[model samples]
Target chain A: MAASKCTSLSGALTRQLLDSVDSVLFDCDGVIWRGDQAIPRAPEVINSLKKNGKRVFFVTNNSTKTRQMYADKLGKLGFDATADEVFGTAYCSAMYLKNVCKLDGKVYLIGSNAMKQELEEVGIQPVGVGPDPISGVQIDWANVPLDKEVRAVLVGFDEHFSYMKLNRALQYLCNPDCQFVGTNTDTRLPLEGGKAVPGTGCLLRAVETAAQRQAQVVGKPSSFMFECVASQFDLDPQKCLMVGDRLDTDIMLGSNCGMKTLLTLTGVSTVAEAEANLKSECPHRQRMVPDYYVDSIADILPALQA
Target chain B: MAASKCTSLSGALTRQLLDSVDSVLFDCDGVIWRGDQAIPRAPEVINSLKKNGKRVFFVTNNSTKTRQMYADKLGKLGFDATADEVFGTAYCSAMYLKNVCKLDGKVYLIGSNAMKQELEEVGIQPVGVGPDPISGVQIDWANVPLDKEVRAVLVGFDEHFSYMKLNRALQYLCNPDCQFVGTNTDTRLPLEGGKAVPGTGCLLRAVETAAQRQAQVVGKPSSFMFECVASQFDLDPQKCLMVGDRLDTDIMLGSNCGMKTLLTLTGVSTVAEAEANLKSECPHRQRMVPDYYVDSIADILPALQA
Candidate 1:
């Protein structure tokens, strides 16, 4: 039912509306914390949802941090969350490579140890540098040598990267038949101290220019992460609520997957900025629009009740 | 003074004919080799200059290589050149810091080792990570622990670089009194195999955005290099000849410094391109017209002897 009739309702009405959601998906990073600082009412919102019997899950395109790590961060921030409540790009990447790519060869890994572990859990052998002594095509570069038998290039962020590695990746991509796959093309990664750093997007662009090839990005905006989420929770897309701060990611993902989207301005975006952007010409203009806009979780209660 | 009049001289005979200069300064990268491969007719023209008793020197904004290195590369390419014939940005950079800025603090070298050697020779101490106890502003990280007691920020090409170093440099630059300097702003550097890589210009931009500050470029367009050339060689500007492939750099530098300029079509700029650009409105419009335009150095001989 439309909750607009409950304009004068208080926290009780907000809880009642949240209880109606069978599945709730929250975007990590901005939605939870601006880098590492928790939003003012994030814990209260999560706790309220839990008390009202809502199934909550944290979703993120950040392949750097593991699911357990996200849960631990949330737990420390006064929000109770478990590993099962977290879903990350690393998990989705592994699933895509295993089910979609049909793995019979050694995989090259460019992300953190968590991604490597996730890939191995799916029965895919992970390699970094080398001539895969025995291989069909190289999947990612963990320790993989440039001259190694690379059949495909997989991209992710690696802090210890060099131009030499980028050059080799370009050389590999020069092969017409070789494929280029990126986990995601996120431009910035949240660092420890509220600072952001250039992520895989920068590296991907370097390779793209050098190779004169485009990569098939497999996470977020691709609908693959949502599909993974649906399958993991065994829920229909229409019944899920997607909550995030960024319109391009959260709202677009939800809209594309046929789910309801809510945009919070407490993260990277503000309501005024989103409104201004809505007036601009954007390619994804029609595909994504937030069903609700709130300044923070505290504001969310009034909006939900209204 | 303008050599014997030829049938080629059709219009504007009333214009004063200035005596031609004997010494010629040629820019290396764009003027001769576009990275690793020599532009068409570049070697032949350079060789012809020597045969015609025209004193020639290769001046480059690239601080990565030493004079001997440039000499070796030119010799391998069938061009006869001594170490003394090559002058790089490193020399001018060190000269500026030592004489103009009067900077005596330990510099955190951020360019090539050759640049470090040049700074050290100029009595500017180099400090960075690994064993060296550093205190002062980071002058460059072309080489890394880019973090130090940097009182100034100096930028140059360092292929093995990360955003972390750039971020730290930006932090140093946040101090209003801290000096920011760059060796050059060439967007792309030529690779050995016709490929291009992001050069120091890209690095400088990253820091510029982070610090919201513009850097004092010390190479090419700065006029400092040209001033150094004029004083060191004891040559009058009106009697000096600047020959380069790019009109924006070589020719513009010449015009700005009151020297005669020659633009060759064999390098970065083509005759058609120059014609098109000449029609545009620019701040340097008066300086746009070259004193001479020729297909190559081979063409210069006939024109000079006319």
Candidate 2:
């Protein structure tokens, strides 16, 4: 393992950092763009990584978008990427059910159709995707129809997340044998104008509190996500670099996988926040602080050119 | 205050316990009935309380039922109850908003029509009652249509609870002055056949997590509900007895309001659970232990007859 030598991420040291890793994993949304518009020079930097023979992968917790959708979005944004190189939670969670849990029965999924498509792509059947609308009274909810074939419950980002879906998920989770898997434990989803909404973690926790069970999160911060990438690409965790905007998820995932972490200030956390986490009494919080931080992912564009 | 000499409630002790408090508050579900059927002689015991000149009040965390609804249910079940004597969180929360918070503005309620009716009874208007359906994309959910007049976010049991409602409630709660109040913090509602459904606590916690704020809960274990009954009936907390099946809500509320607590075996908690709490090192948990435990509320019926 390369011992981190500096807290500062800039200039000639940035070039040395870029040269140190053969593979680079990037977190979408905040690092690359705020929304539709691309972050300044981010695309150029990503393109440069590919040009330099660095294995690049876009790892995101966004379960709403399919791999193909992400690939098309990246292509349109002028980044050198493909569907196989993008590992979204929707896809990885499906792979997790197939590879890790080895689930032979159907999954009671409380998520989007994109998740369903991903599960089907991996030859796994997923039920309860779209709106699980309230058909009867609240009392009827107690006797909610359960599928015996449902051996697992996978929770992700669902725009149509309703009480019916939540109840059904809770019912499925009550079984001790049923595997509980969550796409990510993101508490809040930050939006364009400094506004945020409850993330998948809120729904997962709701069901957890109701059912008294914990879920195995398959998103960043969990080593399972990094393992998915590593085992698939035959990449060594020690030689890979993870660049992300969030400290808890992206940087923590990198650190957990024994990879070097780079924090970009385009999203959720700031340098002061990272410093606080680094100095935190809790070992878990301290583990979340990045080894290095850049003003933006675009800061590496000049270094990559050099 | 009578010093409790024995943990067991029966025979001579039951009569003595009944003679102690002038005001008797009952938790409906477990103590009264498992579901539809009445728990043994619960009705006769309640009726006997009123006949003996004791002020009886039906206190419940269940917010789906309005005061009139609770009264009708009680009447059907053969309890001596009136709309005025029944205080569900729906009614208490509404009262809390009006008399306590002195809320003059509209409430953004994520509950049922029962909650709306209760809020209206107290001359407080409530909006966003049913579903806050999402018409746009998930990202559009960040900028949900907000009502500036909404000074409070009162959450209760709504069957039509959705992500849209959760987001809107969270948006309303983002305002520091916007009072957040939950009907109850019950994690799950157990049914007759060992089945259960996610309770309002899940929804309230989800919103609380997303908004990064704490709600002023008005349910049992909270003194606000007791104050609602106390201020209205001109009763002293010391002269009241709280009878409940659940130790966390009912017995805890009794302890909180400086009243005697009686735990009945017909509900969620057991005598063993109460003993564990009584022996717990945590003072809060210890306070939740009941002053007495009855095999059934019906035990008091025999005492009433004697």
Candidate 3:
């Protein structure tokens, strides 16, 4: 089976692979959708999977949206997904702090309003959302008032990410006891027409550089995202099929969780890159090799129908 | 000499060390002054070094202030310093672009007014200084109007560092032909009373992560800085003494240039830290160990008087 890694999914093999898993985990961007538009036949593939008694879930590293927001977007896109069936970094990071770290204090958040809502939903108070414009001078910034209750620094997708916010996070993180967590490490968020904006990873890198500390990431490729889903739904990793367009995040997450991994070609990575990873001598790159790949998620529609 | 590293400099040893060097380079922040206040007896040390026929220069990683601004600050603090004697990243970065890269077009700058002034001083045009607040959406950012004339993306100390600025840099850097340069890699700007703020390195790291490329650094430890000083002054590296507070930047820069190195305790590093570097088996750590350690730059006052 190891020797047959990164094989193309088609005809009989697609059905055989689908039958082996009781659940299918789909990465939101690129796998099932790109930006605001859904991928062709992605909805049918996901809907048919659920109709066949296979549970479907949307797992994404994007931290800008809450579970409910994802569910709303999914429903609008005809994915038939509920808020309970959605797992994004915003929700997963909240779960990681609540369940894994068992954090009792407030979080100094460098993220979005959706993240704030998600953290609040999990009974974790998050401070420092929205625009934190620079004021005074370097001395004022270094001595910026910090919340005594902030026991952790949470970094995610922030449009208003500024030097002041970076400084604030550094001040909080300077306390050795203060926990540091990041949503993901995806450097750029690819948009339509091959354009890309700096992703949460860029912001996270800046904060990590400033704090001089590594963040406990709670996004794709970190077992925590899979664990967040498994703990809630009692998922068997062996009976789950992880589908994503990015080999580094989605396929790597699948590989990390001991799940059957499928790479859809509607997004970031390509077949040549996957083959290169499979042929690589490095252990880390080898893990990024998916079990199977398709031109797009729509390729799985015929398999689901059969 | 290889066996004796990080020795305490005082008494007759200080005079002997002074006699060995015809030129002395001082790091501004912790070695000469802390924030707005000049270190006690620091001015005397610089003046005395000049009085004894040894050339004096200030080399700093700080990119926020222009050479004139630094000279004004030095004059206000009672130091006999001139604008031409300063070798800050702002000025050195301009020199790097004009001389080394030989940039023929305008620069997309992610830095301060000081950097802009320095670039202009070197007959180079610079764009994108001051506040570049976020507008529209992510797609708008990725498609932000790029100046076709921009041949390079230069990053330095930006108090206005934001996600938008980071995005703009990524867009310019997406063009492989566009050169990338960073002023320094200093992560934190240590302030008075043990407080600190995020430095240009944090901003540079964020852009590097987003652009998926390494930047050509123009600051300390990168021999370009020493070369910039040596070219105009015709310095002999062996006859120059480099004194600074931080071992990683200042002392390492001296070592890289084959100059006599002195680590002053009144700044970011300590004698204990220098000792640890000396004991380390790593070649990189060995280079960080200074030839001598001092309580402060003021300790050289007695040697100058003698």
Whole-model lDDT values for every prediction: 0.66, 0.87, 0.92
lDDT of 3 by residue, B120-172 (tens): 99899999998889989887888899999999999999999998899999999
Give the least accurate 10-residue stretch of model 2 chain B, judged by summed lDDT.
Answer: B1-10
Clashes of 1: 28
TM-score for the first chain in candidate 1 comes to 0.81
Candidates sorted by lDDT, best first = 3, 2, 1
List, residue by residue over A152-227, the lDDT tens digit for candidate 1: 6777765544444554566566567666777877655544434455556655655565566788777677788888
Docking class of 2: medium
DockQ, prediction 2: 0.73
Stretches > 4 Å off in candidate 1: A1-22, A33-55, A68-85, A95-109, A120-126, A129-145, A181-241, A245-306, B1-23, B29-55, B67-87, B92-107, B120-126, B129-149, B159-167, B170-306
Model 2 clash pairs are none
lDDT (0-100) at residue B54 of candidate 2? 93
lDDT tens per residue, model 3, A95-159: 99998889989999999999999999999999999888898988888888999999999999999
How would you encode candidate 2's per-residue C-alpha lDDT over B57-89 as one tens digit per residue?
999999998999999888998988899999999
Cα-based lDDT at residue A259, candidate 1 = 78
Give candidate 1's error at residue B194 in angstroms: 4.4
Who wins the lDDT comparison? 3
Clashes of 2: 0
Residue A246 in candidate 1, Cα distance off native in Å: 5.1
The DockQ value obtained for model 1 is 0.10
